[model samples]
Target: MQWTQCITSSQKRLTSASLGAITTLRLETSLIHGKTILLADLGLSSFQLTEDSSSTAFIGVDDFYVAPEFQTFRDGHVQARRASDIWSFGCIIAEVLTYMVKGSGGVKKFCDKRQFEWVPGTWWNRFHRGPTTPSPEVTTWLSELQANGEPYRVRMVGVIQKMLSLDPKERPRSAQVKKSLRGISILSLAKLVGHDLETAYKDDQCIDLLLGNKRFRSWLSAFKRTFLSTKGG
Candidate 1:
């Protein structure tokens, strides 16, 4: 199959770059076809694509990836900001990291960890209990990633933590997230080359190293492909 076919295929899982692209580029969720619902799909007719900075008002669907604010006011219309997309991105990142470290079973356990009783005998798998507070279970899961001691995982957990902030204003913007990930990728390349991270940080020649490495270049190419293509969509 062609690369685009593979990415759009329901059978293929989203790469980390693809998840980032969805949020950063603000792509419409209708283009994605998969069992996992990454965004609230109330139907295309109910949703509007706008270019304004203000939040868009819509009725939200009952889905795990929907932001806490969306779920909190399900019975009525809710205004969703770009920060809402950041929250869903964070949840997806957490799951992706879990799968990377512990495989499919780990992803299942991660979901089970988030399931909580919101009402009498009614359970929900949400990152937050309400619009303003993150679930303790989610916090604990992030802590586990921090304690894992792997540099890439630890750095990613840091970004995910910020992305999962309860306050919409507290979440980093898409550009900030991109910068963080770029730094992490550079450090990862440094590690692969057995270069001292301190030196890598202090020197301006790190870009040269990143460009010279074939594997890093390939990864960068894939990221650009995923991000730019999704942006165009």
Candidate 2:
């Protein structure tokens, strides 16, 4: 999630990063950063191209981050799809935004009040289906934000609502999310960071941000060397 803050950084953002490395914090930080989803994780290792095909497909995940379709899979109703990852992306985004707007306990409250357990039927059935009303925390924050009529809040809410659609297909693709963010003016973008846009974008720390992660830097160096040798040959 440390990378998430970089993604929202004005001049930097995720222009050259991969989503697979994104944690809950990073996903939220992207919201603060402007839209421009980069798929830098295109490298083979990041895509798990070397993964053993004989390994069983992950059908059931016991984590709270598991998507609704995975829950349905556990119920014997359907199989999980690649799109399921996008759904999990939306949920993580929502939770992060909720935490930001409503304070630390916001997501916790939502999870607690709804009894969001890791069990199969407990999650999707409780949150995705049935007659459960919209969460008051989220609803209240959004409503209050919109009531202010700030373009920043309006645009932010627009992207969030789409990402969190109940139907996975209805949710925006990552590229589309980028497009939406790109459309917003820099002034609106400033509101997300709570200060002058110049200050955030000017931080020199961004240049060496990735180098702080020794493992990623080593892997990147090796990949670069390999690619260069192959090209020369």
Candidate 3:
């Protein structure tokens, strides 16, 4: 499908002398402004947007991450990885974390001040990529979240791990996943972006049920049956 990107800012790009290619530089910045406005909306900041700096822009990736992790389902994907999905979810977490660290360092009051803008939203019909899974780096982070008491944090970590499962077989269905996320606590991220971890979990349940045809379910049933036999039904 054709790319649908938002416009953040524009700048004249002269080819870089070293790489002889155009790069992300000195275009009217969008990341920081967009982030700031979002943070303000999320109740995480007091930053305001201006006419020149407040606008947003979008662009399509010329290439997807090329990897063996792609799984074709629903619509289709190119060079997709479980980690790609994981990364998408991780970005959501990163936003939450950015809020936690909003006032620190060289960053603006809101991250929106960065020079670029991305939809930061999932692609339409984006589903589990099957050929490969997330790296250990990802699972380690997810484990950290699971070990924590914060519900939203755990859900965030778990959701990413589920999306990035190395063995597609161990991954949860989108619906069962939704159930697992049920009741997870979520707080505001940045200033304007609102997230609901609990609601996400509930919605995940619907997806799980619909994708019940995966062999993983039948295998689980058989494995469990071996451990607990009953009278003939």
Q: Please report, in order, the local distance difference test score of every candidate based on alpha carbons.
A: 0.61, 0.44, 0.31
Model 1: weakest 10-residue lDDT segment is 1-10
List ranges where model 2 is wrong by over 4 Å.
1-56, 74-79, 116-127, 130-147, 182-185, 190-233
How do the candidates rank by TM-score, highest first? 1, 2, 3
The TM-score of candidate 2 is 0.47
**Candidate 2 lDDT, 57-159, residue by residue in tens:** 3434444444444444544554433344445555555565566567778767756654543356744312343212334444555555456676655665666
In candidate 2, which residue pairs get closer than 3 Å at backbone N, Cα or C atoms, i.e. clash? Answer: 1-26, 4-26, 8-33
- Model 1 alpha-carbon drift over 4 Å, by segment: 1-53, 71-75, 195-233
Q: Show the lowest summed lDDT stretch of 10 residues, model 3.
A: 1-10
For model 3, residues 111-193, the per-residue Cα lDDT tens digits are 32222222355332121223453333334434543464654555455554554455545544333433333322212131112
- Cα displacement (Å) at residue 213, model 3: 43
- Per-residue error at 11 for model 3, in Å? 32
List ranges where model 3 is wrong by over 4 Å.
1-68, 71-87, 94-133, 145-148, 168-170, 173-182, 186-233
Query: In lDDT terms, which candidate is top?
Result: 1
Candidate 1, residue 35: Cα displacement in angstroms equals 20
Instruction: Decide which is better by lDDT, 1 or 3.
Output: 1
